[model samples]
Target chain A: MREIQVEYFAALREHAGCGRERLRTAARTPRELFAELSRRHGFPELGPLKVAVNDEFGDWEAPLADGDSVVFIPPVAGG
Target chain B: MKPFAFSAEPLQPASLRRSLADPRCGAFVSFEGWVRNHNDGREVRALEYEAYEQLGLKEGARIVQEAIERFGVDHAACVHRVGALALGDLAVWVGVSSAHRDAAFAACRYIIDEVKHRVPIWKKEHYADGDSGWVNCERCASHAQPPPARQAGR
Candidate 1:
């Protein structure tokens, strides 16, 4: 299993009940990983979300790497 | 000082204005986004802002640079607050200096608009009734006006 760091923000944080965690997963891509975690955590499938790998915005289909940091950005609301 | 930045401490608008001082510029424009007391009929008691700082800073600076180039502004800067904030707190600030009023005004608007749309900052509003919600997420889920990424190519 590849290890990854996942950070939650805003609503996702509340749903996941934490800001961050390290997990061992077999998911091959960010999209699959998020789907697995959302099912496990009961997170709603919300869209318009952006995925970031290693702090840089990236595609959802990007392959997962061990120790990669992933951030799923929800619809931002800063003014 | 970098043209764009974020501060967890209280923002000082006077200090920001001072840094943007340029004798050659004839117009100065600014915008301040204050935490309001209410949102969509709920009484908001406070708000907490969180950001992906590493990415937020890079995107913020890029927006500022775009403002300077697209509007022909002499200089531009923006400051956003993080952490807990009470009602009426200065949540965000943007300032632009240009040789003319038009560019300064246009650039200031551009910076604030882009910062809101592009930066990965989240705002959670704590309500007086003890409930809270992430701004845009709950509301946008059903009524999203198309994600920015999809509209970016236009």
Candidate 2:
């Protein structure tokens, strides 16, 4: 099982009431990883969100490694 | 392609300018987001911002790239503050640079607009009356599409 690092922000952070998490996954890509987390955590809004890997913009299909920093940023309100 | 560091404190024009101080940069344009005391008619006390780090930065960079692709620019930086903010705190800021003023100005505007409409950042508005509500990106709202025009009904 590969370990996935997760970070949440804004409303998702508020809803989850946490900032970061590390979990084990049998998932292959970012989308799959998120889907698994959402399934286990009941966060339906995880979809339609853009993701990033190692500080660069990436697609949901981006493959995961043993220690990758994955962030799920929803549509945020900014200036 | 450096990201304009977003924070929860007041934003400084000098610092932003410093960040864009590249010798190759010929033109610079910036957009300042101030703390509006009112929202939809209520007195706003403060606002809180939060985001997913990797995703937010990636989206911000993508917005910059899109602007460069669409409008042509030398460099772009977009920063947004989060956490509990006061009445007059800086909320968001964007800076764009290019070899020409026209591209810089337009790209800066486009970057800000796209970030507001596209990025996954959320704001919680704290009102003066001790009430608060979350403010989502209006442009991203799934409802209310543009109305179709009549095609010379005959």
Candidate 3:
């Protein structure tokens, strides 16, 4: 099991009902971790997204380590 | 000053413009993204912008650097606002300076476009009807539209 810190933004934050959380999980990748959290939080179907590990853009399949921070980036809209 | 940054307070474009002053550069171009009052047929009352600052700043700085390298511009800077913003507020500003007009114009455009598509910033618009939605995530299907064509007789 790995302990990870997950942060939410925009719609994910609204749906997840919190901005940040830390928990222990058996999931090893961001994709798997997101799936577990989605079930727990009822996160909406966000369509296409990106994941960040340790404050850098990360691949969905990247391995997660204990005490790592992750953020799922929804489709961005800025001008 | 850094090439890209986020501001919680209102943006000051004039000062940003002055920052790009250079004796070698003869042209300056800028773009300002304002908080408009409507979107996808909804009357927007206000907007709240949120960003993953760590990634946003990193990506944003890379974009500015890319603009400088790609277009050969002398200097460039961009600032995006966070938190609540009312209608007509300056949401973002980009300034570029170059030895000529062409590079300045192209770099300015590149910075703004890439910033919109690449930066990890999100906008949640509050509508006049007491409804709100994230700009691209919640209502993207309806918001997508064809490229604008030039009007007759400009």
Candidate 4:
């Protein structure tokens, strides 16, 4: 199956341990894709992260395509 | 397409002029947020700010969209500075342009207020004594209400 690449940065980067990765799954939406990816990576600590697809803010229900760049954005406290 | 721009760098007017392309816009509203010298009488020496980078951009973009919908504006831009900052440094800026002055003014105000309340950014207040503390959101009711993270002093 076609896979979409996932990237993490800042707080999410440190927490994920790796900078970038890819997920191969039948999951069609961002939320489900992330859930499957986190499980494979053993990142049970990966909390509810805001997902960004193709450089836009959206929810898990957004469909994914091959080569879609998915980012896990954790809640931050910056002024 | 989009009537807004968002960034995490020092807000500079000269660099952002191209965004004001609409000839219909007659009034431009700009907001400059500077690092202050004091917060809650703590006498902030420096400020270490952090952001949920992607989320912040997303939220800021959302705010601009809201402004566009709420007010008929020709353009809107929001820029914020990241990394460490000392007292009196430019921390953020917002600009809005419209055919009339009133629409521009109202949207500019709304953009900043919404960004402050929703943007996923956090700040840590540093004291001259080498102690630092994250400014709690509960301490300040809103983004604009928080005392400046920096204060004027050595």
Candidate 5:
């Protein structure tokens, strides 16, 4: 099992009901981890979503490691 | 200060513009995106912006740098506001200085457009009807490119 820190923003945050959390999980990739969390949090369907690992944009299939910080980026709308 | 940044308090465009001052540059251009009262027929009362600061700053700065390099601008900067912003408030600002007006204007437009399309910033609209939603999120889903077709055979 790997321990990871996950953060939510905007819509995900609203749906998740929290901004940050750390937990142990068996999921190995961001895609797998997100699937697990989506089941638990009832996350919205993945759209043009992006993921960040260690504060930089990352591939969804990239392997997760212990202590990795992950953030799922939702659609952005900034002027 | 970094070329791109986020401000929680009201943005001071005057100082931001002054920071790009250059004697060699005879022209300056700026763009300010303000919170408007309505969008898509909904009365927006206010807006709250949030960003993944670590990535947003990196991406935002990269965009400004690209503008300078592409347009040969003397200096350029962009500031986006976070937290709650009321109607008519400055939500984002971009400034560019260059030897000619063309470069300055082009670079200013480039920075804002790229920032909107690239940066990891999200805006939530609070509507007059006591409803709120993340702007562009719904449309984004529909417009998203379909997932790559799975291999014909696993």
Candidate 6:
């Protein structure tokens, strides 16, 4: 198991009920971690989302490390 | 000046244009995105924008660099606003300078499109009914379009 920080924004923040949190998980990949948290927090449906690890864009299946920071990015609407 | 950045205060378009002033460039093109009062037929009251600073900065810079190289523009810069914004406020701005109009115009369009698709910025819009929704979130697979406007006499 590893401990990591998770940050949420926009709709995700609302669903998560907080902006950031620390959690311990046994999930080896980001996809698994997200799925675990989604079930726990009842997060809204994520459409075309992106994941970031340690402040860099990361693949869904990237391995997690202790003390890493993960962010789930939703579809952007910026100009 | 850095090619791209975010400002919480009002965006100064004139200063941005001045920064890109060059005697060699014959064409300068810019695009501005403003906060409109309505979206999908809902009356929008205001908007709040957020970004993951660490990744947003890096990706935003890369997009400007790509625009400059791909469009062969002399220079390109973009500024997006964060925090609360009222109606008609400038949400984002892009300015590109090139030796010719073609490159400048193309680069301007390219930067905005890339930023929208690649950047981590998100927007939450407040509505008149005391509810809000994220721009691209909270949607079902069935996205219903707004009904047509009723004619004045009807």
DockQ of each: 0.41, 0.19, 0.25, 0.09, 0.42, 0.26
Residues A10-55, candidate 4: write the lDDT tens digits.
5445446888887677888776676676565544332234567766
Every candidate's lDDT: 0.85, 0.71, 0.87, 0.66, 0.86, 0.85
Candidate 2 on B1-154: residue-level lDDT in tens? Answer: 2764557667777887787777887889998888889998889988877655445676777788888888878778888887777777777888887888999999988988988876656788888899786674333332211112221100
What residue pairs are clashing in model 1?
none
Q: Which prediction has the highest lDDT against the true structure?
A: 3
Per-residue alpha-carbon lDDT of model 2 for A1-79, expressed as tens digits?
8887888766556556688888888989776776676656555332245666765556666568999887765645677
- Tens-digit lDDT string for candidate 6 (B26-61): 999999999999999999999999988788889999
Cα displacement (angstroms), candidate 4, residue B77, comes to: 0.9
lDDT of 1 by residue, A1-79 (tens): 8999999887778778999999999998777788788778877645577888898887777689999999888888897
In order, the first chain's TM-score in every candidate is 0.95, 0.86, 0.96, 0.78, 0.96, 0.95
User: Which residue runs of candidate 3 sit more than 4 Å off their true CA positions?
Assistant: B139-154
Please give, for residues B13-95, the per-residue lDDT of candidate 1 as tens digits: 99999989999999999999999999999999999999889889988999999999999999899999999999999999999
B1-154 in candidate 3: lDDT tens per residue? 6899999999999899999999999999999999999999889999999989998999999999999999999999999999999999999999999999999999999999999998999999999999889988774332222112221100
- Best DockQ among the predictions, by candidate number: 5
lDDT string, candidate 6, A1-79, tens digits: 9999999987778778999999999989777787888778776665767788898888776679999999888777786
Q: Give the per-residue lDDT of model 5 (tens digit) for B37-131.
A: 99999999999999999989998999999999999999999999999999999999999989999999999999999999889999999999999
Restricted to chain B, the TM-score per model reads 0.90, 0.81, 0.89, 0.80, 0.90, 0.89
Question: Docking quality tier of candidate 3?
Answer: acceptable
Q: What is the number of residue pairs that collide in model 1?
A: 0
TM-scores of the models, in the given order? 0.90, 0.68, 0.93, 0.60, 0.92, 0.91
Better of 3 and 6 by DockQ: 6
Superior candidate under TM-score, 5 versus 6: 5
Lowest summed-lDDT stretch of 10 residues in model 5 chain B? B145-154
Query: iRMS value of model 2?
Result: 10.9
